[model samples]
Target: MKVWILIFVCMFSMPLLVAVLHFRMRKGQTLKIRQDYVKNARYFGRSFSALVEKALPEMKNGMIMLSRQEKVLETDGKQEFVQPEIEDLIIARNTIFCPQQEDLHFQKEIYSEKDALFVKENIRLRAVYSKKRLLFGNKIRLLRWADAEHAVAVYDECDLGERVSSGEQLVIGFENVFHSLYAPVIRLGQRPEEPDRFMEERDPRIFRMPVMNSYEYNRHYIDDDMVTEGGTVPYTIISRGDIKVIEDIILQGDIHSDGAVRIMENASVLGNIFAENDILLEKNATVLGNIFTQGNIIFEEGASAGQPDKIISVVARGTITFYGGNNIYGYVVSEGGGKILKSDREISGEYCFPGEPVHEEKITFRDLSEYENVDFQGFRGDIYVKEAIIPEGASVIPKSQFFECRSLEKVYLPESVSVIEDYAFADCHVLKVWESIEKLSLKSVGISAFENCYALEFVSLPDSLTVIGGAAFAECVSVNKLIFSDTSLLKKIGDHAFRGCRNLKEVYLPDSVEYVGVSAFRDCSSLEQISVSEKIKNQPGIAELEKNCPNARIRFREVNSVEKE
Candidate 1:
């Protein structure tokens, strides 16, 4: 009995002991972990210069300060001055300025409170930071970077190196090859004291925005990997596998890949690029819009991004590497980091400019009688079709029937046609001239049926359209309104059916819609209102449409009884 009593006490004591030990070990201790700072790169530098000045005085890591204007007289009648050889810190006493000696090569990062002037010849520096202003005279070579609190003025023949950033203005006098520069006012081969043109000009006489057209929402569905030869592709590309550009080429729209994207030397892309994997830009490659990647972004020599007139963004979840001779007119940001790798020389090759391109495939197509199963697939010559009339008594439009008709303007469907198969009108870049389909029996539209029709305007679907397939009518930039009759039978809207319709302003759905697929109206930036019947407002997918279009107002209205007849 005594042994049993001891066993019972021991069981409770063991747990008590563990609790005491756990509390003792954790006492007066709080976990601390170092996390990398993530921020929007566009607004990152607004307070950087202020933060630098605030933190510099309280810095403790081997920093020397000349706080007093005069030497301190000690009690022993001794005076001492620490003239250290370290070039990392320079605190000016009573605003006294000090300059680097002539022809000196600075290996470590140097900071100064006064003006940093490198007027002498052949002065090489790894990097420089100044609190006031920075000036680089002729024959100065910056190996890595240079930043200042105020202006960073470069002379006519200096090597500006990888990055030159300033909190205020940046002035470059002459043609000096540079990598990346970030400032509000950048004067290239112009004077800083002269009138500022980048900010002042209300309307430029020379520069004007061309015809507004965009294919940002078009996700071209290529099944497998693609290997393209040197040529011009006049549409967007979406591939499940990797895309390898063998030679110089030009793409007129956005590019997305499930795998990697490697643009060969001398290629040009006139739209945004996104990849699930890494994105590589070879020698002298150019991309006009933004570039985003889940992986890294690697820039080869002589590669360039963005135009001189505007700023673009290059964001990476991983790192960004610039080998040399790479220029970006905007943000270069990465969650991991960005580095400037040294390269001895720029890669020289045949560059492909965007100027050369043959006219669209010309064919005044009138009918699809020659196509297989009465489909338009027989006309695969990338032709410019003015209008195509679906023959009388045609029941279905086959898959990929009108794929990539370069300038297909209009299409007329017969009253007997009921279904449009997958990829049926995809890549019809300018197909917006067609009017209402209220008379036809369009029961269902297959996947990606009318994707990438950039100029499609307001669409008024018939009451018979029951199922809208995935990505059907996606990327229709000019599609501002979509309408359905009060008595319409639109049972479902497939996933991403109207995705990337940037100008989609309003939607009017019928009371008969049973389901709306995920992300049906995703990325519709201009969505103003979504009107639905009051009876179906609480249905399965009815409430979720507001999530896809967050700025759009959901209007639940009572349906008119006249259309029920």
Candidate 2:
């Protein structure tokens, strides 16, 4: 019994003694750690204060200025500027600081080598790519260089999940909420995958409201202004600020919009657009200017001013069709099929004119083969001849022949022919008349008599001509020189008839007439000089004479009679 009592007492006392010693040792370590921490904190504060002074000068203006000394002390040994930190922040040009810490707000901040805040943050980064502006929002903790998959997420900061895989696409912001940052897009490339589905998935609030940038957005805009994968589009999303674009834009340069692009009455776009699909412009939604497309073009019924002389060319794969009334000025060509349905209107040909009489002759296949020519013995009626002759006759006379002959080369007018009808000899090619009609009492020449004659170079009209037709000598590409002894008929030049006559170098028209056709002397590329009578100076066509013919020099000669000079 005495031995058992002794053993128990020893065990109990041993336990108490061990507990007291352990408590004392723990207290000593805690006190030592506290003292050391206090001592280091003072040193850190002093070093940071000195370094803050060193970095102040390099900070850019307008950025929120921080208390440099205080911020440095809080960072403790991590303050890189004063050389007190264990790790140093590397600041590079055109780079942003993406802090990994959760407590930090800005993932990317402008990197400045001299700013104390950047120095304390231990920012380590490199320049990825830069442009005019950059924006960010949401709880995006891990910031890395943008890849094809992460592009949309980086821009919108919304969870795209599997919908946005890669390639190019237009991303709509969340509800009336958009990423707060605005950047200019220079170049964009997009490969469409289910274009309609993507647009349909866009949030309505984002589509309805005006957008802008936020502080949570990158405070600093991009430098250098480059666009690697986005473009400036004619988007109808609501936004308050001016939408500025720096690059030549393309939605592929082609976009497929799911809904209507409605621009409010006050909104405007100062750029051009091209669409891959049909464009639906709702009523009251005004497009200020031109819109182009790669596919079919459709306009909803309403008063809409598209573009002035803007629909220069419209190409269709199947059939290009217009629904409502459209005013088209330029030439319209259809490769597949061109079908025109004219509404209530009368279309008639010009039948009555005071010129050559080519249509009145009783031309028979037998007459064309017999004389190698038909003699118009001054019969005052219009006549048409193709690859035939006008023989000199006392009773019967052939009038103006081959007025609008699309294909007929040579014509032989008889010497007895006195009154040549209007445009009788117009548009004739390879016409070689061997001076058969001598001293003929020719009175009038038709409009566009030799228009577009690529082969005829020189020909002589009768000296007794009084009325010269409008556009009589237009587009005679091969005819280079012409002479007229009658100075009085100079002012009666035809309209645009001489246009594109690349070989026509000299022309002489008399001053007897007063009215000239518009575009008469246009595009005479080879024309060296023109002699115009002073009497026709104030004529209507003369005002625009020099504007059209740049190669020709006009000689306002004092004229009673003149030849090609």
Candidate 3:
């Protein structure tokens, strides 16, 4: 009887032990899976942060430090320093100090210290203990230090230049440093590790000086009709009145005027420009940076501003007009009316004409087949038609040429058309089928080309398509099918290309696609299927689409056998 009870107990205990072991192992796996998910999420966040940093202006590098015992030498009625406070200094390895005396003063307290100040080889200033001053409210008191590798000593206010009889060892050298003679020096210590990641990277040419009620204009050219002649101005030019650059001059810095600023033909500005009144850029004038004005802004023919890769802007509180043939590479914002004369030239960025919203005025086309070979060169305003066919010889479609034409139903593009500039057919709510009448020779579609076209269901891309700019088809909520030709040369799909397309069910990507920008298909709730060649499986943007559309099925096909859906 004793042996029988022992066997039964052993059998029951073995099963319990096995069950407990299995439970523990499963719990461990679950915890590890959760940790891995968090890690991946963090990595994605970092990648997006880095991408945003890259898009913005690069930050300024290095630090600025002032020397102790530097006294202000009074000369005439003005005081000058023995050594100019603006002299550059080397603080640590890879760290520099170049303070602008005028802008460096008047800083009350340090903004940060943990990542700003480094001391001794390992210790870093972590916190400020007190607001007490060491030399007449000039020096700040530090409270704590992090990663201290050596013992630290503190002392009361005393002349460090004189030797003390006290035998206390000073681990670090010390003296009351004058950050600035006038303004308060708020920031100190080492420069940021990645100094090239800053907002509105300070234009190095901006005159860093104290705030003043007004600026003095260069009186050397006061007698001359043109403020600047055919020479380079190395520093920023601030004018109290109207200024004109009559000759071919190169400005290394920015220009600011309280009145009108006029740049003649053949002039170039490498920095930003601002005016309280009107600004006029003559023909062939080029500005590498942005332009802002409180009054009207006018660009003559062939005038160029901004760069292709930079985010430059042209803003005017009043009207902005381009007299045709201007090549602006960035955004333009006008509070008042904006007009661009008809020309073959192109503006390559976003344009905001928020003045009076123009409603669509439809012109009925009953026999659209008769106008199949119509020349659309001087065509303007809205057209109401059932079926419209583009002529075979049409070469270009200007910006906003058919904007907000809600009555448009079906439109056909011609083979000779190469460029469709920004907002060419934007806001056409009822436009459905946009097909090429012949083999398409289309090369580029500008920003917001088919945006907000709610009834657009099908779009057939041509074999010659190369680039689809940002927000090209954003908010096209009813697009159900998108087909890329078998011999498609499509290379890029810009940001927000198919965003908010709730009814889009299927898409076929070609093997020639090299880049799909951020949020290319975001908010496509009904996007159920995506077919792509196996060549695009390793693309970074492919993961973005998968993450945004969790329920969408991704079907990878061999390069030669990409099926049309």
* Weakest 10 consecutive residues of candidate 3 by summed lDDT: 179-188
Instruction: Give the per-residue lDDT of model 3 (tens digit) for 90-133.
Output: 11112211121231221111211111222112111222111111
- C-alpha lDDT (0 to 100) for residue 347 of candidate 1: 21
Which candidate has the top score in lDDT?
1
For residue 555, model 1's alpha carbon misses the true position, in angstroms, by 1.6
Error of 1 at 340 (Å): 49
Cα distance off (Å), candidate 1, residue 224: 39
Question: How well does each candidate superpose onto the true structure, as a TM-score?
Answer: 0.35, 0.30, 0.34
lDDT of 1 by residue, 1-565 (tens): 9999999999979999999999888834223222224442323233433444565566564443334121211111111223323334333423313343456565555555666666666777777776777778667878878887677776555776777777555666543556556753344443334443331221221111121133324233322233234234555677777766544556655687888888778776766788989999988777767899999988876566654424567888887776544556556657765655533332233211111112333333233433322212233324435567666677787787777775678776678888989988787888874555788888999998888878777668878889999889888898888988777888888877888899999899887776776667777889998888787676544566666677899898886675442
**Candidate 2 all-Cα RMSD:** 38.4
Model 2, 204: alpha-carbon shift in Å? 82
Q: Identify the superior model by lDDT, candidate 1 or candidate 3.
A: 1
Best first by lDDT, ranked: 1, 3, 2
Give the alpha carbon lDDT tens digit for every residue of 458-497 in model 2. 6344566665566566666767776676533333555555
- Best candidate, TM-score: 1
List all candidate RMSDs to the true structure: 16.7, 38.4, 25.4
